[model samples]
Target: MPEPPPTADVSTALVTGGSAGLGQVIAATFADAGYRVVLVGRSSERLDAAKQQLDTQPGRDIVTLAGDVGVREDCDRIASTIEDQFGRLDVLVNCVGTSDRGLAGELTADRLHELIDQNVVTTLLCCQAFAPLLESSRGSIVNIGSLAGKVGARYLGGYNAAKHALAGLTQQLRLEWRDKGIHVALVSPGPIRRDDAGTRYRDRTDATLPASASAPGGGTKVKGLPAATVARAVLACAQKRRTDVILPGYLRLLIVLGNAFPRLGDWLLLKFTS
Candidate 1:
């Protein structure tokens, strides 16, 4: 309800999984907003390409670091690199995550662990490594979450479980880190419109699942959000210090209704995806 926090003093921002997809877009968004942006990822080739793309945009300060944020040691190294070069970090966006395809009933332990590592552990490690810096700068951390985190969507394998864990973790981090002058937020968007949206899960979906299973959000009726829109929301959450944000703001009412009444929620979800 209060006006969003001012971002006038924000100087440097770091984004994990910044080489491609939503991460890259988030990095660009920050850079375009006049912040020095650092991108961390696993592949140098992809990082280089991302840097090149940002370079063509002109007037954007961008740095790319190759490292797996899911690894504690790698995160520590990344934190060190940022400290050495930038001297301070004002924002850290945890954008490293992977979506899944398959029925929850059919989900396997191995698969669930993999989902947690990719969707949750990576953010946890990054936050741990960057806490001191963020504290020093009174900075903000925005974890990119998914709509799956808010509700148990069907046919997403362990993704709903993984994102739900992330949602809980984000809240815990915000409460635990508040006294340290760090603001943590989560931006959970529905299926985002991307170049490979529908086909990315081709290999993971099968006969047991409907043809829509391979689509984004397991073919949820929600329209695909523009990646840029999601990026703007991330920036706003950091600047505004918002708590939990769901894309298509209207869905918040639906989410609340779903949470309060199980039968009605089930019917709504089924209708939306039918």
Candidate 2:
């Protein structure tokens, strides 16, 4: 692989949820581009697998940390480990999140809390833990959001609430830290086509919607975008210091329409989505 541009001085990126899905691709892309990358995940096995894959980028530095970012103690350890190993962090990618599709009434309190802890709390804790290092480096943060964050969809109440909270936090941080020389941006993508059957959630529960509503190429027939697409968009966002990026471009229209016509948006979403 070719070396990164001479002008690129930023190094060291920490990506949560890097063991799989879009997070894995993002870590690989950064490593290939010569960034010292750290992959954080809950599963040691998956982290090891991801590290092995990124290690193929000759001469690139890769570290795998197995811990849950949703837990404060784990986040502290992760921050300390990065600071001790790298001395400074140039980028922080908050890619730790999960998705679920079920009617609000069907979701138990425990399930709702799980979604919040997995999605919203994980992002918040990581950001809080790493903010000091990023501020010192005058670095950037790229948060992975979702289209559900911008506009609610059928049978995704808990996920939508959590992602929307994440989106709000991203914007608030962007403004709050602007003067501190920390650039914060959000990358919100629609359904992402994972290598594993393009399923949204890692597991299917009894409360989940029918497979037709949850699987890619099922109801709406909208084939999800490749993971690499979002990874590249993240690179661009980091390089240009963009404020927000909604993937596939056209989804931006949905956000606008949803806000401008709430009733119409609800009708459209119901009519089109399974």
Candidate 3:
């Protein structure tokens, strides 16, 4: 947990998927740092839990709205509610995303589309509805990306493709919002444990004994960086208005290097998982 920042003006923030995992941690950071934090998520139970946790702070305003940003109506409704209540939004971090991991050819057309819609359409819609408020307040937007996006892996075709597309969206949005003083940045992360039923166990077991042979890092005894690491990266980018920040700095460096010399990435990924 981080100490609250010294600030007189309490800027408002809306964090999508703020009810759990990385989103929850990021929301806590904003609330602690003197922001009026609004958490958006699909689960009413989780949202209430998040709101209660955030409001426990002495000098904080925490709101929870149960809505899926993937839906346009939901995005519009939340945007309108925020504008009516807060007058301004200073930070918008989109951490709501879903991924379907399957080999490219194994996916049905519908599942493939769902993956794209879940990752790309959802973020685009949320940003679209909130752009006016962000532009007005010179707010910041952080999109969570992935190492898989930067460098594809076996058996994660749909997830990898959508994430790669998200990386593209981050770059384009930064350019579009640059002159307006609205910061837009991307945070690329290695896989982190998502808090769903048996997700952690499943990931660990699969990592140790992958179906498709052994990925190099697969057998390397890796723990996906904790979600807080991601929250920290988002915080750094938001505060500094950086164009891009990669989680676990070393992984970021490797991704960049992998992009230039793909074989190196392939070799590293294959060897470690094995």
Candidate 4:
């Protein structure tokens, strides 16, 4: 039988794609919780700006790294840097992902590949590179997912596929790393309320898609969750070592119901979205 995990309190956390958007909010959430936070992203300027924004709290240690985590070399370099600087990592939150809008048939191979790189590859590379450190600390990893990952919704293009792949990867890593004492979890949430929630995907949609298709959750009737709410769930998942969490928690029942009765599931999904 495998031994139980250590009870040491986690101190340091690293969030990938942490320079802006939901990533920055998650970083702030960790910092607010008194964890020494490290934010990684592709743009040095954006990293610097994020650090400034997050450095407001007294005694909050915010470290920013500029690198593309999708690249293995960059992931290796970041891991090495973290080891040399912090010496331990108790939590890793993969908050990097991109959404798309279009019909499944219209989603070209190249576009699908791009979405995969943005959503799946980046998380995989970061998790692979950081596993050693997390192993030493018996840390937790929370991979941010979307509602699209749990159930298919129309007009999301490659997002649903990419997020579904991420959902599978999260579960696989949790099982594979169980003996290694790493807790991997997926926090699949509905469309988050953001400044650009209603129109972020406008440029990605075309005449074939409804204007509402550019809205959050592709015009799904579900309300947008606050960024802070999702961040809190990520924190809870790590601190509690949860297996899987679906936001708007009630959705879990729907997902299960859908799995059990495919026809009813299809009906519920179609009814939920415009």
- Could you give candidate 1's per-residue lDDT for residues 1-274 as a string of tens digits? 8944434344999999889998899999999999989998999999999999988988888888889888899999989987876788999999989889888787889999999999999999999999999999999999999889988888888999999999999999999999999999999999999889889998889777899989999989999999999999999999889989999899999999999998999998898784
Clashing pairs in 1: none
Candidate of highest lDDT: 4
lDDT of 2 by residue, 179-263 (tens): 9899999998877776666354426634345666556423343457899999999988987899989977886887688789999
Q: How many steric overlaps does candidate 2 have? A: 0
- After superposition, the stretches of candidate 3 with alpha carbons farther than 4 Å from their true spots are 1-9, 193-222
lDDT of 2: 0.82
TM-score, candidate number 4: 0.95
- lDDT string for model 3 (20-66, tens) is 77888899888777788889988999899888876787877788988
The lDDT, on a scale of 0 to 1, for candidate 3 is 0.76
After superposing candidate 2, which stretches have Cα over 4 Å from the reference? 1-10, 198-210, 217-221
Backbone clash total, candidate 1? 0
